[model samples]
Target: MDLDQLRTFDRIVRDQSFTKAAAYLNITQATASMRIRALEQLLGVTLFVRGRTVTLTDQGMTFLPYARRIIGTAQEGREALRRVERGRVSIASLRTLVSPLITESLIRFQEHYPSVDVVVREGRQGQIAAMLHEREVEMGILCWPNIDPLVVDLEPLVIMRERVPLVVAADVAARLSSRPEIAEVLALVPRVIALRWWQADPETAAALVRLAKTSVELPTGPARRLAIKGEGLGFFVNSAIADDVKAGRLVEIAPVDFEPLHRDTAMVVRSLAALERPMLADFIREIALECAKMGEIIDDRLDKVVPRKPWPKPAIPHP
Candidate 1:
């Protein structure tokens, strides 16, 4: 019926004795009996057979799982609260958005506050937005600006943009002329398609995948893997394919107009959290410096893809 009652119920079943369960719960035996009775009355069925060795009735067996689930959820909530109280900062980032800049920022932050804990969750743009709204996380690193509508409650603390190079197989890379312009590459790969991951609108992505003559839209990792396998070409964040580029499996190329295809990503903070300027705020300068190092990437690809859609709307971040 309630968490306490369920806990008591579960304890009794596990311990196989009312007295033992009471002692485990640090309550009197009579109180444990009352709780079990109340639970049974509420359910209109007896849970355990009254005996030396306690046993569950048929209905009790069926109810155990549900009770355990509630207890587990309560325990998780308590743990999350404990972490937050202890000064742990939870941040969610799009999986592709793992740039070295963020990694460097984190390294600098840890050096200053080694005792503070940080939790990182990697997800899509929309999921990160939901986490920010729910207060499940205090900070979010995502592509584009998701806080426009929720502007009153959220603040765009840092915005980062970087050139995503077009990567191709070693053989394919050798054939293309050195430093081709955007129009030249498009002319060469007439079948290539574009993807906009900033807002992750299903309709926009669907159209890109639908209208494009070749090259299925892919997230960071798979796109790299496919390029390495000599399957196709893709635009990728530099950090994501550093190893492959160095190893000569993939070659990175830049077009004069490549910037138009990239998206902008931002680090957002809840306005209330900004006012508090919690531990994370201490590293703002470090993050900004890192962002500067990467340089700002503007001009959303959807505007390039849809042309009609507004610019600065949002990319696949990193691996």
Candidate 2:
């Protein structure tokens, strides 16, 4: 079917006047009439009544829905193809993963491909993996469950552990004459509960269950806010709350190591031969280089920080 004629027919139906349809289409009235006539002939039916006013005949009335649907589908097809050409890379990640590491890589990626549009969809670690597996997204950052399918390749980029610590408000941290140990803090303090999407994994979930107390479990942003406001201490990933720590709004209670959770994020994609075009392959290689640089940065930071050794603190009277 000639989409141009279908468009002409639809416009005539909308305007209810061949002259007006021609004006709207910016074509000569004769051309518009000829296109409409061709469409009607192709369907072997009269589409319009040529009276004082234009009105759809029975055939046109029946064909309206089909025409509209065809036009809509064609528009969507065009959009999808445009996305592919413009380097629209689809990615999913846990909200926590959008910290300095990932964003830094993205910045470099954008500089490399300014025309490429990036679509980032946030979900839990598992959800991100599922999107990659189903090919709903081009790539994703996921923890746990390794990529197993022969068609997909997983390139290990970096392993980062979020430092979950017991924190106190600035005022509260000052009140303590000495550093409080984890068990002591847990016993005396009505600590804020730390909730994270990363805790969905079995190992992390079990660790959180061990730390459960009379606590309010909230999402990462709100939970961090609640802790900052002096509403009891909670467990939080260091990367997620770096700004707060630097600004002195929150204090890390010493010796309360909740064990840094180690997770590896990799770039997963269909094998090189399977890629439809060079654009996607180019993106994958770019991402791999970015990931390597990110891993180096993370390693440098970790190397500088001295590891904390377990130390006992004097007991404080229960308030």
**Top TM-score hit:** 1
Would you estimate the TM-scores of all the predictions?
0.74, 0.64
Model 1 lDDT, residue 143, Cα? 72
Q: Among all windows of ten consecutive residues in candidate 2, which has the lowest summed lDDT?
A: 299-308
Pairs with steric clashes in candidate 1:
96-317, 96-318, 97-317, 97-318, 161-297
Report clashes for each candidate as comma-separated counts. 5, 2
Residue pairs of candidate 2 with colliding backbone atoms: 192-232, 192-233
User: Over 4 Å off in model 2, which ranges?
Assistant: 1-18, 26-73, 86-88, 145-155, 183-191, 199-213, 255-264, 270-319
TM-score of 1: 0.74
What RMSD, rounded to one decimal, does every model reach? 9.7, 13.1
How many clashes would you count in candidate 2?
Answer: 2
Candidate 1 lDDT score at position 166: 65
Candidate 2: residue 259 lDDT (0-100): 49
Per-residue lDDT for 172 in model 2?
A: 72
